[model samples]
Target chain A: MPHDHHDHDHPAHSPPQPDDKVHSYYQILGVALKELLIEKGIVTADEVRSAIEKRDQITPAHGAAVVARAWSDAGFRTRLLTDANAAVAELGYPMTTTRLVAVENTADVHNVVVCTLCSCYPRELLGLPPAWYKSRAYRARIVHEPRAVLAEFGTQLLEETEVRVHDSTADMRFLVVPRRPAGTESLDEAALAELVSRDSMIGVAVVRQP
Target chain B: MRGPHDVGGLDDGPIDPAPHELGFWEKQIDGLRGVIGAKVIVTTHENRRYVESLGDDAYETLTYYERWTAALSRQMVDKGLLTQAEIDARVRVVRERLAASGELAPGAEDVKP
Candidate 1:
């Protein structure tokens, strides 16, 4: 008699085991120091470690630089529009390993990003993705129906604002460079960077004048 | 050759008695090939019956698999084994197959390769 015994035998191959390591919530960002330690003897380990350290040190400064450039230089903004990665690199904050796509939120189009898979993020450029960003609720809901998800995050866009939801699949990731808010025209670049929370980059929160 | 139960701690984290976590029996069934593939399909299905059978937790887990499959499909497309159109077609086909089989529940459709 022909039976599905081959299928039956499959599950019997291995038994369930318990996961003892309670992963640190922060480790999900892949910025944890231990990853560097594990790669100590490897060729690129030193560079990776240095890159992570540099990323942590310069995230705020990078934000400031972008804001400053936008405020002062029209050409820089155009360059940012054309190739954000290169523009950021020219400013001395090159994204490491992670490919970055800067989604520009304008009067017509609003952009939101989510890593529906294992969190592929632009840690070098945007720092860590917030805890909510990595949550199962956000991961499952965002890509399917983004407007509803953004509403949950307290960002309500006008009907005229086209919502572009960019799904961060495997290799590439994204960050939202929101349009400069109206009231913030008076504030300097440093002040503007302070208002740019990680959530703003993820497109959950808009940068507001402080 | 890897059993679904074996993957528990490796990927699923610590076990709990809650119905949300896959139990021993559930893991056994999930280790079967058809169940994994069908669960992947159920996530993409819009049909109410297929959606309801997946339950909330299973649907969430399946989302991870869907991402995995999407990445794999993209890679396959890039490598020329399939095209983007073909991958989209496969996703539609898989969804239809799962919906018709009435095995949208976790581990309900375990088939041998």
Candidate 2:
């Protein structure tokens, strides 16, 4: 493996040791770039700090809110299916660059998403993708063997249901609007949103009553 | 002609759902990229293309943010925003300062790839 070359200097079969002191080449390069950019008057340090905070502010809960509203409001569901970008904008989380496509799950159709080419996730709505979502295994198998992959996530589907996997791109992203679980009519939007997990929005698992 | 990054639908290992906590340096790189991207210094498309073109050795060997930082540095040089020499000098200064402050481990520079 190409990565093996990085371990050549170490004694063979030695356990990996975590070093907190030395900065790697890429880490140094990243800091240098940031400092150079700030010195060049291209961007301020405050801008970078604020940008990180903004990204951290977005999480799976935001997507859950959208899904909860869709479950309770038929009009919102129609709008979400028709124009996801506009629908999300109504929730004050507008996508500035890419278009969002919310794929709906039904009795006979199950929807899932993957970026075959790269990790093109809806970060604004769901925060950064989980580590598994970007793993080579998930990226390689999700598109072709979705049933097996979903099964690994503890999501079992019936033989009659058709599984659909949507491949995301740089300009287009996907969000799985999972079906609301049964017997949740008494729950309000906030409570319903609480049941929605990050994996469920990625279509690996289904939302369940807790 | 599949890029090294285009690993979809081929035989691979089982999915490891273990989550990794983002370190301080990783978050800073992400923040820098976000700020530069928002300022139109580099588009996400360009970032992806650069990352894809990093060759198989780097694409496979480096972590996600490592690739991003490498690509971002290359993009900065290509765009004439910063020169290679300038970046190298800055790196040296950072290393020296850290070492003088006893933050860098001994023989760390020798072990660098």
The superposed Cα distance between candidate 2 and the true structure at residue B19, in angstroms, equals 0.7
Against the true structure, whose DockQ is highest? 2
Docking class of 1: incorrect
Q: Point out the worst 10-residue segment of candidate 1 chain A by lDDT.
A: A21-30
lDDT of 2 by residue, A71-163 (tens): 999999999999999999999989989999999999999999998766899998899887688777898999889999999899999989999
Counting only residues 3 or more apart in sequence or on different chains, how many pairs clash (N, Cα, C under 3 Å) in candidate 2?
A: 0
Off by over 4 Å in 2: A1-20, B105-107, B111-113
Give a tens-digit lDDT track for model 1, residues A84-103. 77877888777654466777
Off by over 4 Å in 1: A1-52, A58-61, B1-113
Scoring each candidate complex against the real one, what DockQ results? 0.03, 0.56
RMSD of 2: 3.0
